[model samples]
Target chain A: MNTFTLGLVVVIYLLLTAYLGYVGFRQTKTSEDYLLGGRTTHPFIMAISYGAAFISTSAIVGFGGVAAVYGMGLIWLTFLNILFGIFIAFIVFGRRTRRLGRRLNAHTFPEFMGKRFGSRGIQTFIAAVIFIAMPLYAAVVLIGGARFIESIFAIDFNVALTFFTVIIAAYVIAGGLKGMMYIDALQGGIMFLCMLFILVMTYVKLGGVMGAHQALENMAELVPEGLRMKGHQGWTSYPAWGSEWWWTLTTGIILGVGIGALAQPQLVVRFMTVKSGRELNRAVLVGGIFILVVTGFIYTAGALSNVFFHRQTGQLAIEAAGGNVDRIIPLFLNSAMPAWFVYLFMLALLSAAMSTLSSQFHTMGSALGHDLLGTLFPKTRTNGMVITRLAVIFGIVVSMVIGYKLPGGIVARGTAIFFGVCAAAFLPAYIGGLFWPRTTATAVKWSIATGIVASLFMLVFMHGSESAPLGICKALFGRDVLVEQFPWMLVDPIIIALPLAGAVLIAVSLLTKHESALDV
Target chain B: MFGINSCGIWLGYLLAVLSVLLCVWYGAKKWNKDDDSAADDNWDSAETQLNENL
Candidate 1:
């Protein structure tokens, strides 16, 4: 790549972001405008912004790389993303979130829950969880983006991470959610085409789709000995049913992310941004299509990259690319793409990274400032904008510290932990609150608390893929799990905690039905 | 075991295409979907005191 061309592309991107930030700052007169776009965002912008924030570097570079190592089994996530992330989210959860939020005049996700359930404790607790857990997610996105930049620009990882953070943090602090959505929409468009190009070009390089899958399937004999020990069927097919691989794929990636998307505070807020039910309804197609292309292509291209690597270098994508799963996509592009194509692709990855990072920081800031602090101080609600801005800076500092400390190969699983935790802790109450009018505040409160406690307990002491690095089970119990080969240890927390959460909520709601507040 | 065939390989993308069509189809059918904008306006934001009421 020509240095001038690369520098020019970045300069243009930076300038455009600055202009977008300037526009957002001017438009944000009230906290309503700043936080929720004054509830008048168009459907196209809302859908694109939601999709962009929903699918970031984690989906493209992180999960895509995982697909390269694990084969196309990760594609199930794409199908589920459309079904749950788009359809169920926009049609089911989003409608109630928007309706109830506007009805309650709630501005933040926790505030929505707090108001709907009529409990300040609910707001504070969930806000605390976001402030504490969200940094890990932010760090993984930072690492994923920085790693890609480091690979291409030949810069130190710290420098790349810092550089990425500074640009996004500045814009997010100035623009808020309105500013973030505009940038997200722009970046989402860039990501759409770039991902499309990557898929088409990759398939073209390795013949066509069928030819590529056939080629990948042909390499099944080359499955690593270590993986084969744990029920490694070839990459293209689903893992052997009931095998460890199947457990990992079905529980960790597919169910973890698919269901998790519905409960995200950041995504839930986007539904309330637009004007009316019809506006949100109109967004269904746009969000679905954007997710289909960006997520669908990345997973597909990731799986097929092994074919390119094997045919060229006679090694699996991971081993030949220095064993860093995160580096597979970058390495694949460097080896196979033209300099110009690589240059454009870097911008797409940058867009993907920035779009999500800004959303994470913004949401975390709102959680701390608008929900937690606002509940405690209440006076801060008068100057909520200032508090939220300060909280954004605090979020960036925490994420930076985590980004610096994080080890390699933590990208995909790191993202999954945040998603799984959110699903386990938040999903039950959120759904119950929306659909079941009989869902009591006492039940919601207990359901959320117990769900979070159980999820945390499971994550720390169990041997699921996300918590595999925690080493708590091994250090304390001298084994991966307490009970040898426990099925619970292999699956993510949602499988256990979600059911438990529902049961607790249902059981408690029924027990308290005679004294229910809704009846009053 | 589906044997890593093209169906297992291609099912996601095919389903994704179907999902897009379904969303678009449903969205078009509901283009005149019932307006819930009245609810937002009916509840005044200036001084509702929903917070205190809670």
Candidate 2:
């Protein structure tokens, strides 16, 4: 746990990561290998890479902090993560995505959509949205990783940010998907083991599994007065239905994170990295267990951290962290975890951050170089790799700038907002394009446009979490939200926008003749 | 259930476990299945036609 030992550990980890990246670089002889891992990736590597990329430090630290405040009600999000994110994603969507990619020769998600719909305009538009909206998500992950580095190394924030960004950038830009997935598999393993230990150790610290839950249940009266008024029952119970807390938990956190997983460009692209349906089918087992352990343990440990904090200092986790939800997990670890484990957990957190960051950066680069720029300038197609590497650097720089400018306490909100937007903007079109041969290119265009506009409008004018800070509604309409009614503002954009997007897509698809030439 | 009184919360936990089991079963059952070629039968021809139209 000494500074020298921690430094040595980090150096060794970085060396391993660099070596993996180099291996990927050495293997890369063609554009296909750089972009899609030659479309023959091992099922285990593909599954773990997907899991690691999907579970970021934001999910662990930010949402875990939220679980500390909200109790085990977050178990629903974990359930949905396994069900929708892994099971349905792999079995239902992954198999078809692989086949479609192979058939269309698509290298990116936007490309897949564009080629499927036989519309260059749709591809450019999807790529444009990804290039524009994804940096905030990437920035938050960068911030999470950089902050951990800052605390562990006791360095300046800017220095940590630079070091973290540069290392991830080096690997992603040089090795591309192949290098990134190898590192992701390694990081995912670290995350899985660390979280498992944390879960068991937390139970041991809290006396036992059932005892911990019972104690938390007994502490229901200890719920803060404000949250109680919002209908918080206990650490072990759901919030009262129709209450503000219930709406936020169910709509904002649960639905947004759950359904949103289906449309993520980075995650969707992973399906294309494998060779066939069989690989995807085989991947479901590892992906399912990996997601369950990583997310399930964090939410469980986070909720139980309340008991640890309360018993140790007669303060709830939220109060002990002085009202900053993001600080609860770190505080709990510093307090309860052994020194050596804390040091080791730093690597796990680093893995979480870097794995997600690498994927986001890769997705952004592909969106730019392969989908947007390549379509806009046909000449750029010849040097697509070079263009993508440059775009990766651009994405990193933009994310770093945004990370420096963003305010605190935005981690969980930022994550949910991005997920909600992606869900509304991409999910309907993605699903329709995948399964419904009746889905027309024109309908997908309208659907995507509707999703983007509706979700943005809701974020700006209706959703209290985003609108309050954005202040666009307040400045224009003299209110924090267009609807001042209770529980309305807490409703996430995805709930309303996704339905609307799907309706538009379906209505348009039904009214128009199916374009058989573009049919899959 | 599991010291948690809320049916919804306990159900959520139980369902999370069961979902993983379902995934495992599904994966094991269909591990060697080769259905992609049939699904992709139209892809090559469709791509050729679409490219010509565009």
Q: Please report the candidate that would top DockQ against the real structure.
A: 2
In candidate 1, position A413 carries an lDDT of: 73
Candidate 2 lDDT over residue span B23-46, tens digit each: 999889988886786666666677
lDDT tens digits by residue: candidate 1, A1-520: 6777998998998898888888888888887887798888878989999999988787887888888888887878988999999998999888777877777788888888888878888889889989999999999989988987887778999999999899999899998888888888889999999889889999899987678778888998999988887767777866777887788779877898888898888888888897789888889878888888898888888888999998898889998779878789888988878778888888888998899888899989989888888899999989989988998899899999999999976777778778878887889888887888788888888898888888888788775553557878788877656554746678887788888998999899888853332311
- State the DockQ of every prediction: 0.44, 0.67
Docking class of 1: acceptable
- The positional error of residue A64 in candidate 1, measured at the CA in angstroms, is 1.4
Measured by lDDT, the strongest candidate is 2
Q: Give Cα distance to truth, residue A6, candidate 1, Å.
A: 1.6
lDDT of every model, 2 decimals? 0.84, 0.90
